[model samples]
Target: MLLDLLKLHLCEACSMTELHEAVALGDYDLVAEILRTGRCDPNHKDVDWHDRTPLHWAAAKGRSELVKLLVDHGAQHCLRSDVGWTPAHFAAESGRLGVLRTLHSLHAAMDAADLFGDTPKRLAEIYGHQDCSRFLETAEVESRSYRRTAAMKGIPLDQRDEDWEVKKEELERNPPYSRENHTSSAQKKKGKKRGKQ
Candidate 1:
């Protein structure tokens, strides 16, 4: 396939080769064409560390437009290198707030705790990105408040105001035993004794 051929060509390209050149040096145009044509996988790994994807490079370099393009083409936002750092983590570490925001908007899981128990919010704080940390903190607080209010209203957290279908189904599946059943069985025994008398 064309994708396989391009992967082969890119793998042969040297470490010193610019990714734009590795794709034949057409810059963003060539990268976009390769992605659009499906001639190369944007998720391809370089040979040296095998750790860097095009997305990783784009994010680390703060190439926001290129980052968006790669993400739209299905480049994974959560792909971690051997050291356990995701593209979002790298963006945060590099202080690329624009790239980080773009990734977050794409639904990259900001709450995903890494091996060190550092979510994107924690990473932002550790790396001195106070603005990013503030945004994440506000979002988290709002989400928690919503859940608490829903819980206090006697609603199941899973229901989330969807007419309680999930709660209804749960009750139906595990219906409680009725006192009527026990009382009726007792009455049946007493009537048998009276009939015998």
Candidate 2:
């Protein structure tokens, strides 16, 4: 069975080693081939310290093609390594503008914080990537103001007002799931039980 063969031949650990080698040698075609087969998990980290993903290696080496391939295959852009660095952070720190652009186009969250609460935007500025820093600023602004419902209205970009409402009837028609509400109810129940005690 192909699945069985893949399981037997595709060592997650070995894939990391191969990924490092491919990045070091800049064998993007070979990297793509390996990734296409679905044998290598692009999100896998090295066994040693740092535990960097394939995206990390490709970004650090400025291997834009390899980085794109890994991202297209569902490599997590938001994953933080042991050193608290994401692929975008690495790209910015290494001055890999191409990799940074690819990541941004994919909607990789520019403001995603790592363990130290440092976002890629901060890293870009700190690393002196003026273009990347500017892109991150624009991305953050767009995210804060743009709405999918408003986008459906086909309003002119220059004329759209912040006060435009989606309609209360429409909002009432589709009440979104509230996990917070559920958690609050659970907390209330716990509080009542504690009071009874």
**Which candidate ranks first by TM-score, i.e. highest?**
2
lDDT of 2 by residue, 76-175 (tens): 7666565356677777766777887777666565555544456667777765679878877876555435534346787432222121123223434654
TM-score of each: 0.56, 0.64
Give Cα distance to truth, residue 38, candidate 2, Å: 3.1
Output the lDDT of residue 194, model 2: 75
lDDT of each: 0.59, 0.64
Clash count, one per candidate = 1, 0
Residue ranges of candidate 2 with Cα displaced over 4 Å: 2-10, 143-197
Q: How close is candidate 1 to the true structure, as a TM-score?
A: 0.56
* Clashes, model 1: 1
Model 1 residue 109 CA deviation (Å) reads 1.2
Candidate 1, residues 1-197, lDDT tens digits: the string is 87677764764464423442433232678778767766556655554653567777777677778887877886776665433455666676567778777776665544544433466566677657788777767644554565567669975532121223344355457645543443332234346767999
lDDT at position 55, candidate 1: 75
